[model samples]
Target chain A: MSSCKFINTPALLLDLEIVQRNARLMLDRCQKLGVQLRPHMKTHKTLECADIMTGGSRRCIVVSTLAEASFYADRGYDDILYAYPLPFDKVERCAQLSERLSLFHVLLDNSLALQQLKKRPLSHGKIWHTAGVELTGIYAHCGNTYGCKGEEQIKAVAQQTTAITLQFMEKLKAIGIQGPKSSIGSTPSCSHPVPEMAMLSEVHPGNYVFYDVQQSLIGSCKLEDVAVRVLTRVIGHYPHRNQLLVDCGWTALSLDGGGRLPTGYAIIEGHPELKLTSMTQEHGRVEPISGELDFSQFPLGSVLTFIPHHACATAAMHPVYYVHSKGKIVDTWKPTRGW
Target chain B: MSSCKFINTPALLLDLEIVQRNARLMLDRCQKLGVQLRPHMKTHKTLECADIMTGGSRRCIVVSTLAEASFYADRGYDDILYAYPLPFDKVERCAQLSERLSLFHVLLDNSLALQQLKKRPLSHGKIWHTAGVELTGIYAHCGNTYGCKGEEQIKAVAQQTTAITLQFMEKLKAIGIQGPKSSIGSTPSCSHPVPEMAMLSEVHPGNYVFYDVQQSLIGSCKLEDVAVRVLTRVIGHYPHRNQLLVDCGWTALSLDGGGRLPTGYAIIEGHPELKLTSMTQEHGRVEPISGELDFSQFPLGSVLTFIPHHACATAAMHPVYYVHSKGKIVDTWKPTRGW
Candidate 1:
């Protein structure tokens, strides 16, 4: 690795053959849309890319943080799902990580968080049930982008995710608890879903794993299914202000003005009407509208891919993934967690 | 430790007593503003906070990544700077980290990067020097929003940094070169600088610690000298859309927009006339014009504080820095480099 081991030239160089062919084309499109794929380890938070997107099946996973459901439920990954919105001081570490995990999901959109998980204090099996307790399902969002949509906002978010999963199963059966089994999804209102009033058995959908530019302006996946990008390199060229600077900035692409869509930045495969208008902290001005492209022999550094409106917000600003092939770099995929 | 042994909770918690009181308050304000503190370990890229900001003074540092100047010149800290903007595929790791650092500096605003660092091949030993680089003077706009300012863009950036330091000292005395010394700084034109341009004896700001809301909308530090904030916690409550859902997202308060102000989402402390207005990853919508402050008793968990308009773009989106005090969480400050 010493073709120069400074290994941090504006860092982030993941190329495990295009992230294992973008994880086997999104795991064969969630095994041909049978659904229940789970993903969304906040997009590559890496447990070796979540064991290559869980082919070693701990199967079901989707956390946003309880430190990634206690790091894949302490690495054995017993079906997790913490997709954000449960806070009453982390309901006893989500009921002691649903008693050491066979399952421990959670999510909510308030009823005062089901009256603060119906007033805490019930994980008693000593140290929160020796580590295998349960309480699953209660998550909901299905209404992003300043949410709330038609059909009385998707039947009021499926009647508030079926009243916060029946108040988390009546406060886990008035304190008897036992988890795993309910959930929700949201690549912008579950890619056009509406009319299911929560009785969720499962549905996690992580931006289908690329579909960005604000999931194609909230129609969810369709600018040719995004799949992450931002290769970049064209070092500088300004011509007074026709601008060109690319070397990817905002720490390798992420000033996320939350996908304004088709406007400031987004070229994915280059010059398809160039955008990325301006950016600092390392430059990325771009702009070509319908002209300028000689770019002084373009190769000051070359490489220029871009196109991530949000592959999990640009693979959470990279920490390894090069995995190319058709273009070459070979292997390397690492992404455990980056605070 | 079992506080669920730490998992990606939107990271960045380095409060080792406010990072050693923000590194002894910027090395006692560059030893009372005489300037020459050197510090810019790309905003804490850890080697024990670069041995407490280089006290074991091999002094001078700036590195915005060459894997952090070869991890502090392979742990010796021999004066670095690489403040970014040198392309041509990083002139062979800037001529091999200026041949294993003794003083490695870098930063150029273009003259085809001093005609490609005077046709590359930089060195150090056997008296063969040549690679001490610098040149960032008149790139103004640390506040007019997106830089570049008056006095004819600072006397055409001081005549393009004195004709690229006399064409990089006549291509390092026609390639028989020698190294060390050459600098620049740009804390909004080095705080009223302009008088001595070339051989710029060292200076590199790194958001003078934390003066944001885009450096108080460009006049550089004012909002009580802003020093790294973003505590956030508010959970949820829409009270007919008065808004408040915060957990600080876009992955813990980043997505650096509003460099010229008015891009909204965070700035509410001492209520500078409160108004987060909108954000999402978790949520933050504050908007308290005037006060009656009860905000539903800020329930669901409370913490709130923000300052990022660019503290090295929110400290390169966190990895560690919880260094607080009086409010608690007294120690922990690591951030050498990540991605």
Candidate 2:
């Protein structure tokens, strides 16, 4: 059986034990808060993890792309929410998908989208009716939460998102639409305990599954709680420059950084003194935080794992993940990517 | 016949005519400089585009990952170079592939990798012999050239990279290996008319096939020469915040910005006043340069195209490309992705 040492470098590695623990933590937190957990599958876009996150019941999940919605919908996952604002170009596919699935929801924050949806021709060549296309909810993402400075700023953004969502719900109600749930959330706001909107039926938080350096800096999860990492090999050492090059680059880890984190790109798992300073398409330049790096410790071919700045963007780079449990390869999961 | 309006949103659209023109320009430039053009396939990893770039010869190509090497080799593209430094764990696979292909090369920059390659055991249970594994060339990326300010700095980086590659070639010769080509290049140095290293056998310039906003900012290519773009739709308009949200986000475009470009994220095609200031997973927040946006001009559901900051990272996000010629999709090409 393939194990950590046998797997290729620059592969996505997941600690299944840690992932399960994270899932349980988030699940229990939502249960305690008396809100339904509709975990976002955009981070780990695989059915196996989605099944575990929803406790083996593929009831509710959020997707970032229409390709994901179609992938899950094909596999008997009916309660799927395309969390991004609805694209008018995909109205036909959305309507057809809505007809097949029990609940295929599309989120929109503008009135023009509502008018377009209202005017779309159904299969019978008439204007859209409530019975023709079923929407599970109308949700708004408070993406600005990522820019929040602290608890006060996060709470303010959350309240603002909640108010906007309620206003959209009222707009829906005025247009003879009823009973659709209202949802609003982001990783920071969902992780915080205060300012929970009671009117919202569900929360869709994707990054809590594998909190990265960015989330940790935002106080959402600790560094050690990060479950996913890119397994790379040190290929070259430039001791004169106090730098080393790794096999992981922007193609493996992603170019999502310069956040509140001290490290520019990613954090070296157990080496605070080391920093991934820069990257090319296929080579990452790592350097010592201070004077010089001892190249002998990390000889060429030695493995070094990195905790990425943004888990969602980093995870999207890999096609398959090497799932491990207690330092052994347990399984391999392939995520459905692309639109 | 599929046109721009009929295709799905967040789709990768490639203008075949533009791509061909870009390819011909680079190829002709390399020929005039008396240097071989080994186009790097990392940007557009499809055999179709590779054929066009190589003039249907499939002779020499640079790949960032083993996956690309294998994909091209399987399709009979024998002269493949794994441009990234060899990963320790993938050494065995590389050796096996070397035996099967006409020419498969691995790059190295440090002595440790050379020692590892020297010590690897062959199929006969003996130390690796030159006959056991064949190398195409020794290559060094003047990746630091991207940080260079102008012609002098770029030329300096080019000279440094050429020196390092020649030094590595000398080391290879000292170990009783001889007659392997030495190469060095990056887009900046390759695009510049000066600093042409006559000693280098070839140059691998990948991003030149589809120049990006970053490349244009670097003065590698004109803005109009950019061949790839992401087709998206305006999804929301927050007139109060002077913000407009597009369906294209970091997932579709990429977070590869903060270059010398005036716009931080991307350049919206035909809209100079707008800047894509921020992005979520599947939502890009666009805003005007100064005043509030005229919401009527960019109504929700209207389409807006964006030329990404980095073409390679942006292309990697899409699985397939809609190849358009004269406003119609003439073909579709799927890129092989994964490591």
All DockQ scores:
0.18, 0.68
Fraction of native Cα contacts kept in each candidate? 0.48, 0.81
Local distance difference test values of all predictions, in order? 0.58, 0.79
Worst 10 residues of 2 chain B by lDDT: B124-133
lDDT of 2 by residue, A107-175 (tens): 655566666677764553433323324555666678788887666777788888888888878898899
Misplaced by over 4 Å in model 2 are A121-138, A148-180, A195-199, B121-138, B148-178, B193-196
Worst lDDT 10-window in candidate 2 chain A: A124-133
Model 1, first chain, TM-score of 0.34
DockQ, computed on Cα atoms, for candidate 1: 0.18
lDDT of 2 at B70: 89
lDDT by residue for model 1 (B1-339), tens: 122113223334433443455456656645554546566666557677666655657567777667778877877777576666676677777678777665565666666666777776565441113223342222212233225444445445544664565466567658766443444554444433445442444445555444456645555445666556766666777677666777777666676764234436556555565667656555566766655545765665666567666667667666666654455555666555443
* Residue A6 Cα positional deviation in candidate 2, in Å, after optimal superposition: 2.6
Estimate the lDDT of model 2: 0.79
* Model 1 CAPRI quality: incorrect
Off by over 4 Å in 1: A1-63, A66-183, A194-219, A224-250, A254-270, A273-293, A296-311, A315-339, B1-40, B46-48, B51-53, B65-82, B86-106, B112-171, B175-330, B334-339
